[model samples]
Target: MLVGSPKVRMPPGPRGPAALNTLRLVQRPVESMIGWRRRYGDIFTVRLLVFGTGVYVSDLDEIKAMFTGDQSSLRAGEANAPLAPVLGSRSVLILDGPEHLRQRRLLLPPFQGSAVERFREVIAEVAEAEVARWSVGDRFRMRDRMRELTFEVIVRAVFGVTDPARIERLRSALVAVIDSQAVLLVPGALRRDLGGVGPWAAFQRRKRAADALLYEEIEHRRRDDDLGERSDVLSLLLRARDEDGRPLSDAELRDELMTLLLAGHETTATSLAFAFDLLPRHPRVLARLRDELAGGGADYLGAVVSETMRIRPVLDAAERTLTEPRTVCGWDLPAGIRVYPAILAVQHRPDLYPEPGRFRPERFLAEDPPPYAWIPFGGGIRRCIGAALAQAEMAEVIRTVVERVDLEPVRPEPEPVVIRGITMVPRHGTPVRVARITG
Candidate 1:
């Protein structure tokens, strides 16, 4: 417990001019965060147009407290309201307390143990097939290709949809929905449709098209007698029942499925994009990674994934809203205050990671990072359920790419990181050339 004078107030932070701060964040999220941390120490507050006032904490102890604190007092779901337009109000990302736990319990089995291994095989197959489509000496956007691969992997592995036409329909709809997500950053934009001409209206149109397909699939699957024996996430979810033996409703199923599709594919694809972007810049690291893949050593591959996540985490922070007043790191916070665990800042702390900007997979090989020091997947009960699957997919894809093809950066300089919806992605989509077909 942090002891302090009773008069101690909230941590130092930027005041007023919320629009300017929000613009700064929108334009350069990672740089703005680092600047504020340097100027204001471990904990600071920033006012934003969409989220109002938010306190960002980079202190490891404070972050742990926020993650492990009483569930009744901290609500991560509420903090995720901005995503509700796409994920739906009933999604696991928007539900809190007992409801969140129940949904989490129902969703856990499909992402763990043997289930993840099965997903890994599906990911490998998808990567190999996608790689086969890439011609040697062709220049392409790595992130776009990665997104297509990850999207297909999740659709097949999670949804169990095998029809090419159906898959294409879902793919088109999902892409449109994802591409239009920027409207979410604009307050009240999602609420006003503006007669089908505005961004919000366009998004709604795409969402409805996607929802129809998802619902059709769900209804069809519910009638299948063999659902119980299937291993995909949708199958498992359809068969799940709560303590009272009640199955999830169709609406519940739709929201959860959408959540998995978006969260599962988007972040993993971005992580791979960053990995590809970084590897070409460091020949020694790339050589070591290739050697590890060729020699069938998985540890180095895992380390590379870990290192990529540490350096370029897709989501800048994990957030929770306070339900009651609490003292964190000697700062008295009021109820309803939003607190952000600055994952990006914490992972880059010089004391925790020397020369943090350098891409060094060996740092992970040296020893495990301290608890909460390297939390790309956040932490505690709200930690990303897809963490294991994401890591596995990244390793398998990296290995497949390195074994089958040689790659080089399309430009001399590294791509800039830019904010896309809630994620940080390479501005130029990580352009690279397929130098040759190695195998």
Candidate 2:
């Protein structure tokens, strides 16, 4: 799409010191986005140390056009380079143009609805085991439990790592990398390896260890005699081939595995954490969800997950780079500009969602939600590959936990949202007390 140069203009935005902008973003990104949208309108610019020129878009029509825009013009891989250190430079998340399409097409089949459905039992079993270990009547951080639960499910169902020793080994290495908190390139000497001892050094060590295990797994899976018959994601990936019939190389396989591991676990776990935190605090929703779960139907359970993500999206925005000058949302964006789909702002729009502040699952259940309106899994071609799997995991886990026990918020008020790594999670991990164990 092209527009007259006179009609196309740079969107209005905040002009400030980069450090101040970065600080506001780091401190309260969701709030900052909403404030910026109000101040600067539907589309605006935010300059951060990380993203040189960030343009955020929240209008539904504009988001739809941008998402479905020419892939060559809107390159997500360049915008997602910040994740390359962890997901790898070859990861589908960090590849653009024909290369990105090749990776995405090859990676899409295993995460299809039918393939993900086969793992419901795995999700249930993992969630049940974790929930069972929770001590009744004691306050605990739900995020910790959810993280452990999601990580185990991913290891078993995605990697097919059922062996106790291997599972523990992979788990240890992965946790070290994930918990390091500098994967996205933090500031100053902290972002560099200081004689192999500081945060950056520790991250480098953990990443190396994790990479070793992942490479070993890839090599083993490639050699599996019954690789085609295996139902795990890694096995499916092993069998996947491009149009030219070439299989993924060890490096490609390793990066994709890392993408699935990092993208799949913490994001889902954080969503589950938010669900658990929100459910007990809003007794009406909890009671209704339990009533639906008792009937062995997930219609309402699905709505609850949708509502939770709507209210508390784990990731605030998704970024795309303007590879060529293009008109987006009436703003003439230049090449090299980073355009962000403001998920948090769009999801919370009062016009789209009445009483947007309140926790309401009925909003989703009552109507066919508008497109590009509730994009927790993002939208269009660059949408999350594991969207179906993530939602299924959330439903099964929530079903497993709610049916097995009763819970109450440790504090009367809702937990404050805080930025943790790439995800926005509950500040105190959404503390909760188990009132009783039903099963």
Candidate 3:
């Protein structure tokens, strides 16, 4: 039989409905959670709105273990089951052990090292082309436009689809699926357990349509038997083989592609949107960023992207379950209780960072941050396979934006950020005015 409460008193945490607090945290994750950390200290557990369980950790040592723990002991799939229906049963993000390792290896070559260098021009050209389309005096929702631009870059660079007509159709369906996922974030068993069947069914129907297009391309390449075809993530996956020397199944191919498309596109777009939103508010930081860009080039902007991700980190926290009973940050967490290392909470701790709320790229410049202090792309075996590619993509776009157009924050209230399912985005789309510096 399970114990009612631990023999020792649990770490102090917010009183009242834990689930409601968690819901609010998702709505205003960073600010409110940081406040909790301030009041409750580093490690605390709050029972989320009935049936939901959560442990929030800002303590560095505990966080390191949470991220770097043995995979079997801290499974993410069990904790994130709500995403499976949308991401698909075989999605790499939901897999574990040898399976996760195999998929990641198959996916890594296209995202990092020399493979990334191959796509630099494509990313830059796409960014430049999109920038040209923006009229000088137009007021655009920066969040939506940034998503469009990054989504196009991801489509072109990863799938090699540069045709305007086909790309627009793909963008539409992908946006529908992502937008549906935004509604599923509210924490409750009713929505979480059921998978929002009505809208989710609609989302999957569109996803199937998108998959037909992706798989057609996959099959077209397979039929050619041309291993030396032009490079893209699709081709890389097509050619990658497991130790058994078997190619990925069609379902596996579709799931991984969907994973990349969803994960690679939206998260990067959110980070870029957040970076742009933060730029105009901190004039000194923005001016310094421009100076750094002028002198250091794209790498300078890359650092800014890293800092933006660290501060507002697109995902508020990554969760894992303890396989065995263990003491973490003082409390004895029993087997199967979930632990959430608050990336935003840890990053904003003034104890760890000086003036943590302020945007400063220099933090990522020289020294590596303390482990778990920065995990925008996550860590350990479950680390994001596309980290390097996302960085390069963000760097290229920022450079292009700065070079071609000057963005000014319009007179409007700043939007609060919120968690929608797994990805964090501005609650109200970021609004801005653009002026052409060079047409």
Candidate 4:
């Protein structure tokens, strides 16, 4: 059993000058986390301008306990308040306790089971169409292409919108809101809408325009008598009822839909971009993956996706704020302290993954990593609801690309990973050349 004095103050960490640590975090998150772990063991604290003196834990057992702890003891929603401007106050990402559960349940059906299976054809079709647009010898940023492809897929399959003009309009509005999100990283930028000029005002304007479109879509769905015939996520959400037999309010629907659209496409596209970047660098792995695809085997493809996420997770860590005082890794942390499960650090630990820097999909096929050791989508009840769809989308895209076209890195050296707002993406956006199409 674990042993430590309960009265000990919070774990050892950087007594930071705040701004420096925040800069390090934004600029070089993986390097900073790993460096801290080496100096302070598996758990440590770092203060940021927004979240003061937050504790970061890389120990797998502690991460498991914290994620599985009672809802009352940890508040993920409160910890994620910084995301409120983009996702809205009622989004599942920002709802706590019973409300989160209710919204999650209402949102779960469309991304699970048969509903997810039905999306496979749509994903493959989109991938094929997007891949067809690339010409041999063309050098392009794979992330940008993946973003366009994933955005188109989500806008059609998830939003239930098929009109070309309406899809383009939604896409433009979302891009404005997404592109302007870097302002949130400025610490106090989310506090209020200045409403006059500059980035904050621009963000508010973009958000208002996007929200107007979403609210209009929700209202239209509510009034549509043929909603039962639709297969999109919005349609499923529209049909959902709580135990009390109540449907979601228009605001609630807007929050959830916006949450899915933003979260679903961006992260998955980044992951795909990383996979494309990694695959060409390791020719043997690429050959094996292609062989697996040709043989109608999917296990290797799944492993590739798993390894990609494990190696280069988009989010550096999953964070939660303590709602009740608790002891973790022998340190007594008070309520309101933000605790982060260092996903990137833990996944890169040499003990958990031998030769941690190598891109080896076979590592996943050899043996499953321990429970919390492989948390690309996070853990416990608050795990990503779009996990299934994301995995399926990645797998389908990889298969389609490998089967149809031959791509190689534009340069022999790999591109560096850089932070884009909350996600880590290839610095040059994974530029690659389409050597040729096999068929």
Candidate 5:
């Protein structure tokens, strides 16, 4: 590809306050981005909700180049530093090089091998327990319910206890803190002048409280080294030792635990909510998927989850910075600029996916998608660490739900909204009604 100019014009699209354009996306990110794709080519620039410019890259080659670059060339941490306040400096999600690899290695076992297998039973049990709480013919917020269920599942699986009181309080506190959306680089003076300073202060206090409790858990586990009785991620992480034979420090363990808890629950909850909402609205697609799952059980359910991610992906994009000044997709880009591999946008491209908006589960079958064309967990070095574990949990939960309960969306359709402090969710909530699957 011939390299172009540093002054390359951003592909045509909406321009306004970062909040304005971003709110449009938050209201419906997938749709708005799709509209941009229709107008712009595979790549465009949006000066949206956060800080700085967001370059949306839907081209597979461009995405590959961005993710596979050397750290000095392209680093995830520097690109995602805005998340430092929420995820902490130690989180593996944003770390790079040796540190990133070290964290990922310590993080691998729990999500693989027999440890992950052990989670199957608990995941199904939790799904059953939550479904049991739902009444036939009664309307309820699906996102809210699933969010609670996911948090409880992680808490029990990681903490080895399902103390309802503690879990409830934690969930409420998390909701309060996460519900606030603070764009990176939004001036403190502007926020203060706008009278939003107090809420930001409160969010910080709540985040500290959450961290305090988590650290306490880490300390308690550190002091007690009886690992056999506990199968939780925390227990395993606490026992994890580096090549020098030292267990993870209190801070390292806390960081990993919080990362798993937050990342594990939020994405899964939003995905399930989207899948459930999309199912009934597209009866033909839903029927085919249900039939496939009914026939193949776990295998079919796995495919369904992958395909669901492609169609209605929970995450919009992941960011990376250019290492050296380079050209991508025939466009010249300078160093220090950011690249956003728009996951949903790439999955929706007509070139990659025919009838892109249609909910087609078959597209993810072994023979269907091109390499790197359909990434819900992402690809390359920076792929989601919990990908396998998440798939395992989702398979069990979806199977349990399909076998036990039949659900219908209470609303005409779901409206995905960015909850925005780190992740996104539906604006109000994805509400639905459930009835038992009859014999």
Candidate 6:
């Protein structure tokens, strides 16, 4: 399904087998990308395992151009078709142009700074309760703890599910689907159900269970007499009407809810895991953050979160396929080829952030990187809808954990990066031993 053009002037890249390039890229994405950027310079191309001819741009000027290109021509939804199986076709993640804009408008109100700020209390309460259960000297994976905390926040704030029994049931069902998603990334030839005996079949079963719980919640909320009085995301979305005074369909509601649950539950938790991994290894940075938290300052805490995201971004790149032939980053790109802003490569540019490999939250405190240079949440009109909410959750979780307890890395070296579903996560889950309970 790759869109190709005979007249296309493709950027220079490895002339070898696409499968081999994809194999190394899949095994070690960050290192492979860094090597490609060094070898091929600012802009280059790679043919994925199955996806064809992806051009990667790391320069700020080109990145800006690609992000701000003509909206109609840049078909991110088509490029994101792989997600449709899990997220559903109606999801905001897989829609393009006008339909995408419509979903964004209806969903934007609840994710605003003002709206997300309201969840701080809920996030904090969840954080405190979660850390409270952490034994003083026990070694544990911060990723595991963070996932539990994030999932509970989604259940309470996003779904407004308060009943202990119902929350547990919903959480269990959702995690089942999330855990088996690696089955979706393989070649189409290998994705068959095989009489309900394969990973795909198993994944389908989990997806159905999760969908049933979600649909139940949607219908149950629709019948609630006091829905209008609630401010939970699900409630607000339920009350939302488009310009035509039309409410979202049941499928729309379910897909959007699933998208949000996946974003907040996976991306934010993984970012926090990376933060925990970095802080214990960098004593100076850790000390400065503890001081800022102790003094009740906000700027440094915000900077810490920004630096964490910039250094080890969860999602690798924001993708789009061209519907028509268009010039991008000074290259005569053909329609159907995917163009990536190369989020990881751009952020690690040595010129943009001196000593890019170091974990220095102070750099963010002192100065801002160039606009296109530090895009972890992405840019343009298509930026991630949950950006503000994700950062707020990260801040509150980090604040609560640092204030209540001290953590020490279980290993001398920080955990290496590994792919988990779509996000880059700490390989060892950032194992740590709770050093002390300060608060």
Give the root-mean-square deviation of each candidate in angstroms.
3.1, 3.2, 3.4, 3.4, 4.0, 2.4
Candidate 2 error regions (>4 Å): 1-9, 181-204
Which one is best on TM-score? Answer: 6
lDDT scores of the candidates, listed in order: 0.87, 0.84, 0.76, 0.87, 0.72, 0.85
The residue pairs that clash in candidate 4, if any, are: none
User: Which residue pairs does candidate 3 place in steric collision?
Assistant: 18-48, 19-48, 19-49
Candidate 4 lDDT, tens digit per residue, 299-385? 999999999999989888898887777888987788777889998989889999998888899999988998899988888878999
Q: How would you encode candidate 2's per-residue C-alpha lDDT over 380-436 as one tens digit per residue?
A: 888999899999999999898888899888877887787766678888888888999
**Which whole-number lDDT from 0 to 100 does residue 120 have in model 1?**
80
**Which lDDT tens digits does candidate 6 get at residues 23-59?**
7776677787778888988888898766777988898
Per-candidate TM vs. native?
0.92, 0.92, 0.90, 0.92, 0.86, 0.93
Pairs clashing in candidate 5?
73-323
- Model 1 C-alpha lDDT per residue in residues 131-161, reported as the tens digit of each score: 9998978999999899989999889888998
lDDT of 5 by residue, 104-203 (tens): 8888878774677888788888998877776778678777777877888888787765677877766676565455436334555543424435655666
Error of 3 at 362 (Å): 2.5
User: Which ranges of candidate 5 are over 4 A from the true structure?
Assistant: 1-20, 163-201, 285-296, 366-368, 413-424, 435-439
Where is model 4 more than 4 Å wrong at Cα? 1-8, 14-16, 183-202
Give the per-residue Cα lDDT of candidate 5 at 379: 68
Question: 2 or 6: which has the higher TM-score?
Answer: 6
Candidate 3 vs 6: which has more TM-score: 6
Steric clash count of candidate 3? 3
